[model samples]
Target: MFKFRKKKNKNKDSQALGGLDFLSIFMRTLKLLSDFIYVVIILVMMLGAGLGLGYLASQIDSVKVPSKETLVKQVSSVTLVSQMTYADGSLISDVDTDLLRTPVESSAISQNIKNAIISTEDENFESHDGVVPKAVFRALLTSVGGVGETSGGSTLTQQLLKQQILGDDPTFKRKAKEIIYALALERYMSKDEILTAYLNVSPFGRNNKGQNIAGVEEAAQGIFGVSAKDLTIPQAAFIAGLPQSPIVYSPYNSDGSLKDADDLSYGVSRQKDVLYNMYRSGYISKEEYENYKAYDITQDFLSSGVAETTSHDYLYYSVFDEAKDLMYDYLIKRDGVSDQDLKNDETKQAYQDLAEEALKTGGYTVKTTINSTVYNAMQTAAATYGSLLDDSTGEVQMGNVLMDNSTGAILGFVGGRDYNENQNNHAFNSYRSPGSSIKPILAYSVAIDQGLMGSASILSNYPTTFSSGEKIMHDTSEGTAMITLQEALNSSWNIPAYWTYQKLLSEGVDVESYMSKMGYLIDNYNIESLPLGGGIDVSVFQQTNAYQTLANGGVYNEGYMVDSIVDSDGTVIYQHEANPVRVYSAATASIMEELLRGVIKSGTTTSFKSVLTGLNSTLGNADWVGKTGTSNNYVDSWLVVSTPNVTLGSWAGHDDSSAMSTSSGTNNNKYIANLVNMIYQAAPEVIGTSDKFTLDSSVIKSDVLVSTGLKPATVSINGSNVSVSGTTTTSYWAKNGAGNTVYKFAIGGSDSDYQDAWQKILSGK
Candidate 1:
């Protein structure tokens, strides 16, 4: 009975403990659920805060950097040399530059502005927000739909965005970048800013620097030399229409009238449409628009300023090369650009492609140092002379030059007869045997400098042979008499020249150094006959410049035609400074002047007597110096003439050194002399009268006697009535019909009264 009671109590206790355990389990489950709900609420709030911070960060980053279009709008500004003027101060020409003008605010508006902005472009620009969704959709649909042609969905804004924010290179990545930048720009900036950036960055044309120019204002001023404010509605429209493809619509793209005319017609039509659009948009009154549309736009637009039409004037071209190389160096050094950046295969390819595109591009204004008037005259003169040549005989080629004696400024030049036929400029490119023209510089000038021979010093005009087997002979008229050094120069006696060379060699002067000083050398010559003026080659350019040094009073100033180079922005990039060095004594130059004067008066160039006589009378008895030369077998002919103000040179020859049929004449009747005569006829006014030297009366008579170019004592002639006193004798009397002495002139004697004698001989007084 006791055991049964104990078991019942134990069961009751177990049931109570079980009930407490169930309650504890239920409470724990409820607590866990409450904790989970709290966690969920905290996570929701945290996510909301993180998303807000991320949005703010994106907006902040967007505001920090400019859009790609804005960045592209800022191009490298080009520098150039401003033009120098003549003594009269007329502008030689405008300078070359990339920037057209200073940027202006966008609020200002003109009919030209309206026309340039809205005509054939997005006509609905006022209604769109940096994009035209409809156009984009249409383009995408056509392209994706595999239509026959791919359409451009870019609106005017998008195009501007591409040009101003992105670069000229077209790529998918860049396009995407442009879109992003354009969208961001639209969000943060006003419409006016976007338009301004677009106008400033869009390429209207190229400048003389070969850099792309952007903006109508800059293009108008740069290409037309007129300000945007001064441009008419049609002009504005013309600028506006160019950006579609500037080179393709350029007026100066070709020489053919038909092609140029076609381009002009297309440009004009597009310009008219721009005007009409401006009128319809109320940007301009209908009457104003109509007046502009009727205006003549084909008025030789390039003539608005200086234009570089062709590649002639090799000196100018050389300066251009130097300037370009300098600029290239400046760019590399200043910009810290590596060689790879400049000459990399990819970069070269890019430049090549750009060059191809540039061929069609126009509206570039290049201002060079070349004087257009002088250059034109020189070209015309060369052409006239070339036309006179019988190409069948192959004596047609020619070279010409005009330079400022004081400054060594090359005013005019012609490298060849015609640049079209022979692109090589013989004046600078072809080196030929200079013949006796080099005698004056290398021999006479050196002699004067060494004090071994003065202008009045006497030298024997007799036959002599060097130890090296080089024979020198004088002309027969002079005989073996004595003549002044000045007389020998005038007559170009081979013996006198040889003696002078020997004297120079005997002195401490090294032949190589002396030749280099005078800027002449024999590339290969008969060393034994070095004094004979053989085997030396010189370009017409070098000869002209060397002569110019004489004209400039022995100061060796490099002859250059370019005055300055200017950028489109009117900034000076290069202004040539005189680089002068004394090459010879002033006395030597004066002596050379005196001798050259004798040449024109009475020397080997007697054929030019009529022209020289006329020229002298016109210049108030002013004296000029000149020289004539003919190569062996008449392969080359050269003539150089100089006054105080100008020096001119001419060369005539076949490019391949082949002898022309007309060149076979025995008398050395050089074609160069004929070409020079032609030039004088065309521009007689260019010969100035201020040269101070007077012709030496004694030298003139002495040269006349030296026609056979020997000393007077060594010549022989016959006459019964005339008395001969020297080692040789010549007849002095010309008898009349009755055998009376009508004219009596001494042949084998020096004349102290040369002036009176020449007057009697020339005037028959």
Candidate 2:
């Protein structure tokens, strides 16, 4: 009984210890649960606090501190580089303006501001506190439907905030930022200051420079060419509406009257809204608003700046092309932009955003070399001839190029009939047949280089034949003729040119090598038959440089259109210096110049005769050394002239390569010559007389004579027998049938009239 009791007590103690162990386990489990709950609560509080801190940090970061230095740099008055003007201060085709922001303070500008605010955004802006509650409510309701409209319901201050702080993209984050900025702006600035800032930042239109129109004043001056103070109510409204979409609403962008119903309706509607708002806000008297509301919308709102010049001449198109090309290149490199980026919409938008950022960051200014007045004159000349020169006719497309010989500055150029109709630059880009223009260089330079002929060398114009086994050259000019090298060049005689080519070939001057030296890649060479004076290919820019070499006394100065480029800070980024290199001897170029002058005075280029008579006579009788080239079948016509001060080359041809009417008279039928002369007449006086040089009389001697492969005997009318004359005047004597001594008589009178008579004489008229 004692043993059983002890065992039972041990068992009871063991059971009690087990119960205690179970309690300890339960207590440990409860403690773990409590610790886990505390951890969960701490984690939740920490996450919440972290999120709240991040949100607050973002809000603080969004509040930008306005930098006065940045603002000064970004918003200083931009002085447009004033274009070099004529003596009379008439703008050359070039324009210059200050780049910094200019304020609009004119009464007309106030009126436009009042009108635009009322018309586009709020009819109750005067009573709003930085926000239009109704419009905001409407926008919120619209957002709920998921079809957000493009039209903004933001007040002017909000709009300014969006533009300045939030950027152009309409996004929720941007809107929030704009609201914050608007509230901040309202606290720091007056309504007028906000409005002025808005006006200064708003884009009213685009100038050729790719800059947006800033203020009402700038918009008025840029779009209408008038000051803001002179703007009419209708004009103001029209300009105000442009900020909505400048390219789309531009009067110049479309083919319609400024008073087109759509345009007037839009302008009038906007203007009325503006007036109604102004009247309600007491900014304008009820009478003033009513009177403006009654103003006729049909009347044309003419602005007063530079009157648009009309250009019908081909030369204008050529120059415009050069300018456009330069402009395109400038834009491309100005900011390291690419063509593909311009083509892609998203990329383009990105570029615009970058540009806006750059505008804020600042660094770009473009300076052109064109003279505005000269450009205008060129445009007018082009416009005058637009109807007569149908671009479709390969015979009469016009090309004009004007450059300052001394500086290599291209003053004005026109490549085609119109830039709107055709964008290809005929002046600098199009390669046209240069015709007889290539003859002077060939006759003077190539012949001398080959040791075949000298400037004063003489050759018989008598007909002869050439054969490279299969090809033959036949002289088509009537009668056997003889002419000096200079005379041959001035008259553009095919026989002399052929003979010269033959002589060069005999002297081992390969046709390709010779042409290559003169800037041509001659792929085909028919020793027996080549288009001697028939055709040659070259670009206006190349041709201009060639003539420029002659003008600069045989120095080749590369042609350039941009004078200088500067950063927004007025630091020079690019500076073009004069680089002159000798391409030919002074003697060779002088001889060529005299010969070319003979062209204007007496050669086939007699079209310039009337225009250059006075100048030619007074300036040592120095005339343009010019050449008139008409393509075979009259497909293209070219007139290239080089003066001491400038080199002007013009071409008229159809883009399609169709034939032109040769019936207009040999030299008179060509339109390019007439166009060139018009440009010369209208040229600014800054391009003074061409450099003067004395011709080396020793280099002017007439020596050797050989028949061109086309004519047989040298023909001369000595009292009518048409006797053959020797190459040199000293080698042969002349006499009439009476056996009396006869003298060589000039076939035609002054150099101006000689060319026509020579042609008639050559044709046996």
Model 2, residue 751: displacement in angstroms? Answer: 36
Scored by Cα lDDT, where does model 1 land? 0.54
TM-score of each: 0.49, 0.47
Model 2 CA lDDT for position 11: 14
What lDDT would candidate 2 get against the real structure? 0.52
Model 1 is weakest, by summed lDDT over 10 consecutive residues, at 731-740
TM-score between model 2 and native: 0.47
Q: How far is candidate 1 from the true structure (C-alpha RMSD, Å)?
A: 23.4
At residue 413, candidate 2 shows an lDDT of: 77
> Can you give the lDDT of residue 463 in candidate 1?
44
Instruction: Report the lDDT tens digits of candidate 2 across residue range 1-765.
Output: 000011212112111112234445445334433633332222223234445433432332333434334432333233333222232434333332223245665344555555555555555555555555446655654655557674656787776654443444433334444543444445455556556666666666443233445676776666556776677766665666666666555543222224356754664566566567556766668888788788874354442222233333333333333334444454346534456546756545644553434333333343556676676667776777545555333335566778777677887777666677776777877886766666556544655543444444455455444443332232244424556665666666666666666666666665564445436655556533354543357777777777877777667777776665455566765556777766666656665676677667774544555544533433324345667666666666677777688887777767777776653224332344445445546653544555455564434343222222112244444335544333333211111101111222221122333334344444655
Off by over 4 Å in 1: 1-319, 322-367, 387-392, 458-484, 510-532, 614-621, 661-686, 694-765
